[model samples]
Target chain A: MAARKSSQSHSGGLELLFSNQRKHKVSIPSTSDATTGQPSNVAFLIKWLCDNLMRDPRKEMFVLDDTARPGILVLINDADWELEGEEKYELQAGDEVVFVSTLHGG
Target chain B: MNGFSGTDHQVHNLKQQIAATETQLHSLKLQLQQAEQQAEAARHLSEAYQGGFPAEWMDETLVALQQDVTRDIAQKVRQEGGFEGAPSVRDAAQPRRWPLEKHEYKRYGRQLIMPEVGLHGQLRLKNARVLIVGVGGLGCPAAAYLAGAGVGTLGLMDGDTVEESNLHRQIAHSTARVDMNKTQSAMEYLQSLNPHVNYNRHEFHLTPQKAIQIFEQYDLVLDCTDHPTSRYLISDACILTGKTLVSASALKTEGQLIVLNNPPRPPGDALGGPCYRCIFPKPPPAESVLSCGEGGILGPVVGVMGVLQALEAIKVLTARAQRPANGGDWSTNGATSEAAPKATLLMFSTYNTPQFRSVRLRSRRADCAACSAQSTISRQSLTSGSLDYVAFCGATAPINLLPPASRVTATDFSRLPRDGSNVLIDVRDETQYAICALRGSVNVPWTGSADTWLERALASGLSFGGGRQHFVMCRFGNDSQLAAKAVMERTQTPVAVKDVKGGFKSWRDEVDPSWPDY
Candidate 1:
């Protein structure tokens, strides 16, 4: 697995761990300064997480509805998407979204 | 006879030697034992303090160093033609002082233009130096609104980096900002939001020296930081500087706002006027309360409070007269002076039943270390020797006597058995599951409330009542844990339930992060 970044104490408790299973970086179109390659649009982010980043729903890592977006954890900085909004949340260019599997421990 | 005499002498000599040898041996053993103990203690201390930098490591490092770079920026900007942004000064007062932009007049803008605010109020805001200590959930919205409302110059102070987990409610940042410094990231966003407003970024912790120095420069201070240490520091700094403070918080659905000013003023006809300490003199135990980060909050919930803060800041700048006091306690409600004073306190509840209240805050505590210090240097000195205020405020201590579990990373996580032992059961999504997971146990992907999950688990015959225990887990171990705890409270079940320390990630490293470090 690729090394993931750990959340610091003072920054609240947000740990960003991405799936090391994929070797390639998925490109999400930048809506904010298009020339800057930064993704500022929330809709684009949802599409990116659902289509490119999310794995097959049938897989352990991918556990969202087959017709819907894959089960992904959207952390705005370190907060969860469920508490805020799902993919509908507006994203600035420099913010981060960590993709994790929803299969959870059994 | 001669033989008898020789025997007695020999016996006496042998006894003396034996006694001397015994004393020597005892002293040597004691010294050896003490040396061993010291070595053991040193080794343990090293283990306890050693580690990869925490997510807030940068923040901590900034605190450890000296030199208030943030203060320097504020002072420099204060002296050298204001922040690089929109024209700040307005007309009427200092002519040719600077080109003053006349704020476009609007109706019910009474709050914006009351006599106090007139042209002078706008200038105070324009010339004001406000330092926001954190840019997380509370800090993010507070700072953003402050900038948008045109609080002339804003100082963003936070030593933390953005993380993916914070995306939930920290709207200030986006996914791209992960691993970036929060203060710098926020500053960039604030500047973009309002090009005309000048913003200063303090990519360091709020040391007393820095806090006092910066506090001295600013007209008011806003406490949006999360931790107790920072809260106390902000409070102390404000009192010492005689500046107003707009402190706000939102944990889960409940939110609070307190406005404190130096030289505490009585609640004339106004709503509530109380210092931050009046409501909470000292920081509460960390475990006694849960933060929005740990407790979970709705997005708009915080947004509401953030906007209110802007209103309060504007109110202070605009109010013309004292509020006419009604026959009510100002502490529970906000000040209602028809003539709002230049300094006041305002607090509210955004979620559930929304209530607007203000109180008259008590003046500086004669013994307040932050304020009321005879010597400025003495006040500055207190911050360094001050016990880690966060910990001293009881934020660091674990609530449970069972022992506060230490946090370990996925790299260091070691899984244990799941045979219904002393562990807590966490059943949340896999993504959350990956970052923090308990080893060798039942993993049920349970989302939603406890009532929903419990009813389903029971109807499904999951046998949660079995010898095996369950401790529900979620990110920050908030909702699920609360659900589980609530279930236990209502049912009084005999199940050994305990929320994993720091939830899953905490458990993974401290208990067993290896279960699956995603």
Candidate 2:
């Protein structure tokens, strides 16, 4: 039921997708608006994640401040965020944003 | 009538002078034609012999003619200009020869046959001096490939010693070299592979004071280091020293490669390629970072990135040394002047469909603190140790959430009852537990939920009677603390939960000498 609600919201609001490899999965809100009632962008979406999904937002043990984190690659509609103006790239209806981490040992 | 007669006499004298000049011009033309024939014959002879004939026995006249033709052809080519589009005639005329021994040719014959990397490119490779920062998973394969390609000099820098755990992905180090200095171990392996390569070993760790000085000695720098501090340090050092950096990083099943701070073609007319800071101005919070030991990585994923790093390094080194011969499409662009080298970032994911993607990176920022003309991170600044890379990248604070009472040292934990009355939970991953584990210990991998496992264990009557304590452990005691906290939070009944201090590493060092360390 939660998965269906999140999928239905994908057509209405910004479709946020995590790379399947991520450790945790959270249900996206069905409404088209951000939790703060502001237009959803990358920074606001990150805040939404921390406030709603994370176990402890104060400790931020699960996720760091995504805006400043260097290792996480953000893709906007399959293009690099760097090409899409990074965090400044505004989210549109049905816009898909994907986040993947690049910080692991080689 | 007297003036007309004087004019006629003057005209007759002028005609006689012109006749004498014409005769001289005709004779000079004949001589020029003979010289042209001689030069043409010499060129034909040279082309036919193809340098097989000994120069000492050749006619003096023929040698002079051959030299003249070469000079004239080179001059004409120069006059035409913009041969950046064409296969350089000068390059083709004087075929580059590898200055090394015959054995080197046999050693790198496979690489030499590639049209992009012919004799000229091989010679360039032989002249390259590359510095590989870390002799870990990424550095091992990169250094191996560079050595096999006959890179003239390799500088390996690492302070850590090889461990049995490193043998899985750090392929350059073998089981025999366990406990040996990583730099020394890697050098021994590389030297065995190619004795001709000059190995420069830096046994000390990379500090800003030493990074700039060491980077200045090498033509290219490879950021194979895992930590963010080392990544920023290598990028800054390469920028300050005017050396190209081929940086590669792999984590889990993903890897990334980027060539940073590549010097502009004309050198300093415009800015060089983007430095690491231009893209990643700051590092992620230290709490979010995880090493391969903690996160785990596929060996081949890192190997793929390492191999790509070597490939990019070869391209940069060869392109810098000589223009690509044989009209090779190695040219990144057609424009000659004001063409800043393009920076590209490559991302590879081995999961799912196994995808490799490349994105064009932005050019060097005019205000970039490291690589720009008026930047702040100068060689002097680095040498003075004013730029603290570790502090800049935020030091990883010691993970000490639980109080001292909730944690027990390895020495104390070793003395605990090994009988079935007490339960010891090893929180390391299955792979690590398979390697080596203590007796009478149950394996519970440190995942998101410790409560689920604890509930199952309690229901199964593993923790049966009174006075039984649950002790959690991990590789280095970090994850064990988290596990202990999780269990403490979830248990409703009166139960004692404590983590082993310093994990199994400390156990191996302080408690038992026989336990094999990863």
Candidate 3:
């Protein structure tokens, strides 16, 4: 089976749900983008992360429908995902992604 | 005689040797390139191992690579023939002249031996003035490490008093110190850790007018405060005073850390590191903010982040110390240096397999309101108390969404009939509801959102006082009010639904002080 790879890490307490594996070398099948119906992009990445990574029962913390829940900042290669067209940005090999929830409790 | 006069025979022999050596050199270069590639792979594999287990279900090449890496790392653990002994410190023998006090060598010897922090770096730490704001969970641990490291002048600023709840995470403050001013309690603990360092206690909250003045006295500031308003104020003050800021926050199982104003570039300078405003641009909504009491925090989760703040502070301070005071090409903002730290945010999740992550951050924004070239903030406005941080961040005023008469005082609540005819809906989440609640109260949890518990209960033929009275309660009155409003709107029949003002907090205060507050 053909697979495309991208790495992602979780922070801001989202890790507790993803089997506590902050970084995962995900293997996405050579499938069409879940949203765009084209090549796999971050939209596919989000769905893929939610389906594969989450080990905890609380899936609502990291995901909401097709995109990451609000307040979780996604960085594509150290740049805000928003600057890179949010989930529409095409997935590239070796893309370093970070999903961060800005925690305020001290 | 003619042949002996020129030495052409010896020159020819030398040329022949060079031709042979050149062919050998080409092979050696090819071998070196292959070795470099193997080393790169080994390094990547080691990093993966450090993060956690490698994906075993990868392709054949990756599986083979993992085995190779495992073997390579095992070989490194043991040197040829036997395990290598620890390397001796470079200055095992005392120098003729010593700058640090005699005891200081023994005090900081472990860290002093590090190459990054040698004799010169120790002196910088000894001279550095650091101000830690908010002597709570984050500040308590941060102050401890900074003090232990012997930062010459450590100033702790916090107006809060230590309480029993803080003892779990505020490591520096003991049970005996509870009720004492946080700064004073921490100062006592920090002084015990390192008597050589000076400690200053500013037992007052930081205001817009006082922030810059207090910051002016220090070279670096640690923002351990729990709120967005203080965070913004601290960054602005740091940028205004040209002092570096190391900030951290943690909640539940996750934490975030960032170093702001590292170059301490004067305000209006685009070369400076991004200020808090530059990165966040806007504060999180006031209603979204949650205190440690409301959200709950893990002890080590915040402790680790605070420790990272101290580490980042050490990195910044020591690097600055190693450079020359004035003439240094490597120590400029916006300059390229291999050692220059990329603007990044470090995130940690205690429950995650690889708990730490570093995300590269953009430099100062071109239009930041605090640090950009077109910044609106000025020292004049800050010192004169003209800047309204609360207004800017949108202070969490009391939740006044409901009209009067819908809310009842805690005293009024206790006086109500408990004949089991009236329903007391505990609106807090399940965990809290299990902790403590009014006797015979029904649990219909509210998660700060539109809860379906009321609808579910109503549809299941559960009588809400049979259309007489339904009471809503939460840990705090805020959520209860929201829940009460939801109930009033959801019900078809006109029913009396009143939110107990101040919820259980006021219940403990006005009615029964013995009720568990946590």
- lDDT winner: 3
- Give the true-contact fraction for every prediction, in order: 0.00, 0.56, 0.53
Candidate 2's C-alpha runs over 4 A off are A1-40, A47-68, A92-96, B1-105, B264-270, B321-342, B397-404, B414-425, B429-468, B483-495, B508-516
Best by TM-score: 3
lDDT of 1 at B352: 17
Weakest lDDT window of 10 consecutive positions for candidate 1 chain B: B90-99
Q: What would the per-residue lDDT of candidate 1 be over residues A41-78, giving only the tens digit for each residue?
A: 54555444546553333222222333122323334454
- For model 3 the TM-score comes to 0.73
Q: List TM-scores of chain B, every candidate.
A: 0.55, 0.70, 0.77
Query: In candidate 3, what are the lDDT values of residues B1-518, reduced to their tens digit?
Result: 76874678778888988966765565455445445655565566456445442342122224344444444433433322136454433321222123456899899999988977765567778878999999988998899898888799999999999999999999999999889999989988887889999998899999998887888899899999998889889999999888889999988777889998877787666656778887777665576566788778989989999999999988888777224437752353235554323367888767665667677776777788888767899998898988899998787778877888888898987887777667788878778877887778878766434445566556645565565687888887888888888777776777788888888989999999999977
Interface RMSD of each: 17.2, 5.1, 4.3
Q: How many Å off is the CA of A4 in candidate 2? A: 14
lDDT measured at residue B139 in model 1 versus the true structure, 0 to 100? 74
Candidate ordering by lDDT (highest first): 3, 2, 1
Q: By TM-score, is 2 or 3 better?
A: 3
lDDT per residue (tens digit) for residues B168-287 in model 1: 767789888899999878877877887777888889878775677777767667776765566666766665555667777665444556566522333221222334443344444343
Those runs of model 3 whose alpha carbons end farther than 4 Å from true positions after fitting are: A1-72, A77-79, A82-88, A91-99, B1-96, B268-270, B321-341, B451-453, B456-465
TM-score of model number 2: 0.70
- TM-score per candidate, chains pooled: 0.48, 0.70, 0.73
Q: lDDT (0-100) at residue B177 of candidate 3?
A: 88
Please give the lDDT score at residue B443 for candidate 1. Answer: 54
